[model samples]
Target: MSKVILITGATKGFGRIWAEAFLKRGDSVIAAGRNITALEDLKNKYGDLVLPIQLDVNDRKASFEAVNKAKEHFGRIDVLINNAGYGLFGAVEETSEEEARNQMETNFFGVLWLTQAVLPIMREQKSGHIIQVSSFLGLITLPVLGLYNASKFAVEGLTETLASEVKGFGINVSLVEPNGYTTDWSGESAFQTQSLSVYDPVKAGFKAAVSAPGIFGNPEATANVILKLVDNDNPPLRLLLGSFAYPAVKKVYEERLEGFEEWKLVSEEAHGA
Candidate 1:
């Protein structure tokens, strides 16, 4: 049976790749994005397999309308992939309040609104999967990516709580933590603040690290992982994509646990035990 998959940010990068992959697998796709021309192109290429919608996920009303449109066209939405976010690069002090709020609007609040819109349909069907395309930056942090990290961290929390709340309805929520992939994520899709000399070294070093050959994983591989995840009857709450993502997140959690154990006595005494 062909499943209905709805994806935000479906005009480019991982979202586009995921949409194509699903369509190739005989699935019906509702590709939602802000670009009408790109969406039209998708429809032209995929024909009836793809229903392209002009959707700006930051607009709450638009988000709801897109979901409703998907449900109406497909009659059911089996998967909702919240992949509509951009990276905001700059030091915490360097980014302005407006920039931070814009980042939150698209990366955090956009996910919330879209998920809220889709939940009712999924609840009625009693079977659906919500996939959040977060980043490995959500687990760890980079010096200049503070704002992006904050947005993804918010998503991490939201997806986790949502998973618990919707489990009884057969809705599976999963956060896909992808490491650096060969995408426009850092190019056309990224936002950056004016550079400050104080953070130049931090910025340069981080750039060098990620730009190293073979450090970034394949975007196709990430899409493949998501397809397998959706096919499973029991999916995990979190799925880390790429070889580097799993090890990197594991290291961060290990360090966090070690640090917590070191402060166990002080933490315990805070309760006046």
Candidate 2:
């Protein structure tokens, strides 16, 4: 059966790749993005299989309206891929108030609004899947991506809670945590805060970390994994993409566990009578 999948940020990166993959497999796609013109080729090639909508995910009203429009046109939305977010690069002290709020507005609140908008529709259907494109940074952290990490960490908490809440309603929530990808996420799509000379060393170290060999994965390779994820009857709550993600997250958790063990006496004493 052909599914109706709504994808945000469909203008480029993983969003566009996944949209094309779904369309090629005879699924209907509501490709929502700020750059509707960029999706013209997909619209032309896929014909009615794809609907390109101009959207800035920061607008809560527009987010709800997009969901309603997709539901009306497609009769139902079987899957929603919330891939509409960008990276903010700057050290904690270097980030401005405006930059911090904007990052959360789009990356965290955008996901919240869209997820809220689709809940009623999916609840009514008694079946649907919501995929959030988080990052390996969500589970850990880095020097220059402090704000970006906070946003994804918020997403991680939100989606984990959502999965538990929606399980009984037949709504599946999955967080697609990818490590660095060879996408424009860190290039054209990224926003860099005004730099301070004090943070230059921190920024340089961050740059070198990302530029390391095998740190990034091909964005195209993710389509099949996404397709299978939605098709599976028992999907994972958190699906880590790329080779770097698992090992990286594994190391972080190991350190976290060690810290917990070291503080076990204090932790137990704090809760004691």
Per-candidate local distance difference test: 0.91, 0.94
TM-score for predicted model 1 compared with the true structure: 0.97
Question: What TM-score does each of the candidates earn?
Answer: 0.97, 0.99
Candidate 2, number of clashes: 0
* lDDT, residue 82, candidate 2: 97
Residue 224 displacement in candidate 1 (angstroms): 2.1
lDDT for each residue of candidate 2 in 1-273, tens digit (9 for 90 to 100): 999999999999999999999999999999999989999899889999888888899999999999999998989999999999999998888899999999999999999999999999999999999999999889999888999999999999999999999999999999999998999999999999999999988878878887898788999999999999999988999999999999889999999999999999999999979
Q: What is the C-alpha RMSD of each candidate to the true structure, in Å?
A: 1.1, 0.8
- Which ten contiguous residues of candidate 2 have the minimum total lDDT? 202-211
TM-score winner among the candidates? Answer: 2
